[model samples]
Target: MTDTTRPQDPDSRCGFVAIVGRPNVGKSTLMNHILGQKLSITSRKPQTTRHQVLGIKTIGPVQAVYVDTPGMHEEEPRAINRYMNKAATSALKGVDVVVFVLDQLAWTTADELVLEKLSSLKCPVILAINKVDKIEKRETLLPHLDMLSRKRDFAEMIPVSALRQTNLLPLEECVGRFLPQSVHFYPDDQITDRSERFMASEMVREKITRQLGAELPYSVAVEIEEFKHDGKTLHVSAVILVEREGQKKIIIGDKGDRLRSIGQDARIDMERMFDNKVMLRLWVKVKRGWADSERALKSLGMNDF
Candidate 1:
């Protein structure tokens, strides 16, 4: 939204590009790689990205405001899942270009759900075949790519390895071609639309997701209590909310070891991103089944926080 209201660069090329896909299709990874920074948190877990993370990449004459949306899929309409779905689908509207990212060879009903949503879009949609590095046989992708291409008349069809930094230039250039000529919306140095505090909360949540058991991630959310910098060192205090006390125990670990690891890992990332020493204090508090309650979700700052 910040990028949308900025002054236009009359002659420069700038446009909003929404990156949409099913879970674990590397939407966040692609955004981070393209921006050359980790603005969106990523993990092996599906639906790791809960918000619409915007990363702005201003390269010379082309400034691409990349909207990295949460994975689109069918859900039970739980409060949290509905929130994530809303974030993803809402991002698709009012964008100049749409990047429909898909796994290299794996297509599923979830991907079809995302495609169904794109049916009404008025912008040019680019089909990006992600995770191509996993495909050892390049020839196998030809038939699949052709099949995908026939599904819709995509503005461009590309195969890329988001994690390995492969074949992104052509993708960016091709996207830039669809963008209307306009003035730069953001400063050349600004890479993302989110604040440092927001990224910090996501980093903390990411560590918990990466280190915890498979079932724990869906039951967790991060709340940033305090984020401040006293010139030399940045101090951040955050709360890790879990759905149940047992889940809280898992996050805290034996003798609080798991909690310590989450804090340590998050601190390291905070230091790297903030370019300053970080003192991160994390507390685990049980807010039972908050993900399923719309009231709890609202209180947890799920909307525009």
Candidate 2:
């Protein structure tokens, strides 16, 4: 006899929720916090996310598949930037709910771009004012909240701090209410749709971005050349692609100290995520004009959207 019990509750709720915003608005952080794990790469740098990362959360009868998309920026100086914008815009389509994340009391042309995109969305749009923890005056928020309501007829407006884990329960509840009635799309144990190899590359890229900060622009990308397992350890070899020899030198640092530091940080993260010891190898190579070339971008998995 085959014992396959029910996959989910008969009356469970499940749907896709796209999290959209401008660059550096904490969209990835919010999705990571909501899932209680880091499914998307995040850094202080703008445009840190260049693809649509799916983070799935299942609790009881509710499952929310959150799409953490690239930040929408108006400037498409290169083919990669245009690809990022396209990925973010595509996340809005066929979604059951949309969470428009915004920085606390700060609005820019980029935010306006996101707002303009949301103007025609059919799903429920929830305005989540993030970074409220940074706000000193609580009373000032009321006026800002009042002003935000005029922007659109948002389904719900919640003040939250994705970094501090504040008011997230309310936000989850609000999101849950909008999910349609359906069986879960993914297994409850599954946290993300991406493979371990993809996550390894993202970890390496994140470490580079965090370590170098503004020193390295969007000219860097990571590709996993090898992923294998032996005994109890997982071995990963990645190549860091840069646009110029000078950029390669910057990543390698003096006497390769910077590269070693980046490797260590990334290995630690991989260990935690994989729950196994990691043997990570990194190499920096100059891949000139890869970002500006659409074919190169597609080869690097940046055009999957």
Question: Highest TM-score among the candidates is held by which one?
Answer: 2
Overall local distance difference test of candidate 1: 0.89
Q: Write the per-residue lDDT of candidate 1 for residues 196-236, one digit (tens) a residue.
A: 98899999999988987485758798888899989899999
lDDT value, candidate 2, whole model: 0.93
TM-score of each: 0.95, 0.97
Cα lDDT tens digits, model 2, 102-147, are 9999888889989999888888999999999999999999999998
- Count steric clashes of candidate 2: 0
Model 1 pairs whose backbones collide? 8-183, 9-182, 9-183, 9-184, 10-183
Candidate maximizing lDDT: 2
User: Least accurate stretch of 10 residues (summed lDDT) in model 2?
Assistant: 1-10
